[model samples]
Target: MHDVIGLVLAAGAGRRLRPYTDELPKALIPVDGDTTILDIALANLAASDLREVAVVVGYKSNAVEERREALERRHGVRLTLVHNDKAEVWNNAYSLWTAREVMSEGALLVNGDTVHPVSVEQTLLQYRQQEGSEDIVLALDTAKVLAEEEMKVVTDERGHMRRITKLMDPSEASGEYIGATLIEGAAVPALAEALQATFERDPQLYYEDGYQELVNRGGTVGTAPIAAGTSWVEVDDHRDLERARTIACRY
Candidate 1:
């Protein structure tokens, strides 16, 4: 198993998941009887032996911090809390950049809003088995096409992702890029470079822009095919929340 440090990006405004998120941070929105979305994410990480979790918080920052602190206290997992002040002006990519200083090599970048039915241990294991082949190993669901609001990844026949686009047209999408990804330490410098250029060129763009830039520059972004037909839900709207709740109960 990789000595992975998990960076959970919980700093989004989550405008899409309004009403519920209108008052509290998205990570705190309850998914079930007691577990919040972020709670599930942390539990998943803990199960995979990735105990160290750093959460990046922005909107409703206090609420996020309190929730994280409580979870840390109860679970006894070591968690580092990070804050982003510019979340109102920037997309999630900026929230990610804010945590780059704390990011460790072979880090698992997890989106706080995502809840997966599958274990990330399998994904991490695949990444470890691949050895020195690529820098970023994305967990991909090859059969599903995500919605327009979701990030899309287009991989070649060799399972090498050639392009990643935030705004995708159905005619162009190949698969849904899941929220969890394993990034090798070697890939960090290039990712940082791409992000720097992106901020200079279009500071308003999402972090996916940087990933796309990496692909455009011929960076090695590999794809690991994850549990086919497995359920993976992104809680972005009320419907999504209901769907996540339904799936959460069953899973």
Candidate 2:
């Protein structure tokens, strides 16, 4: 994974989580015992051999910075904290676009709120290596039931993504994108362009919308499904946090 730097989007305030997010960014919220979501993400990236990790921080950026040294010592990965000043109003499209420099080296972009085992990262890496695939390879939960809130995906028969958005009907979705992806160096420019277009169109657009724009530009984005019976959750609220707590221990 030398060529692949780990890029984590950890800037969101997670308003839906309310008091829990009042003092910390969503990435710092503890999911498994005292191990925070960012901790899990960094640990997973380290396990996957992604030793160079860039964390885009916002909300209470200082809080994450305070923990940076300890995280690096524990996980053995170089950490670059990219501060996002517009994190309060703009969405993750802008959050991701701000990391254009780091991502230019190619990246394994993971949403910091997601709590999953190293298997998720492993699956994405193995698929990219074994298949010799190019461009982005998003981790899809083909077995999971989709909901309107989920970032859904629709793919062609050959597994290339056709559409990726929450607006799509669950019936039309091929799978739910679990927020882990392998983005190649060659595709970084298109991804950056797509992210720019997405934020320009609407500041509230998600980074996933950027992926859709990439597809519109005829960029290839593939999918890799996690192995069966592996549990993972993206913690966005109190209930999801509880679910993460339960599942995280298994990991």
- Candidate number with greatest TM-score: 2
> What do the candidate models score in CA lDDT, each in turn?
0.77, 0.90
For candidate 1, write residues 126-222 as lDDT tens digits. Answer: 5677556577778877777667776788878777887787666856777777787787676787887777777668768767778888888878788
Which 10-residue window of candidate 1 scores lowest in summed lDDT? 117-126
Global CA lDDT of candidate 2, please? 0.90
The Cα RMSD of model 1 versus the native structure comes to 1.9
Each prediction's TM-score against the native?
0.92, 0.97
Give stretches of model 2 more than 4 Å off.
none
At residue 236, candidate 1 shows an lDDT of: 82
Please report how far candidate 2 places residue 207 from its true position, in Å. 0.7
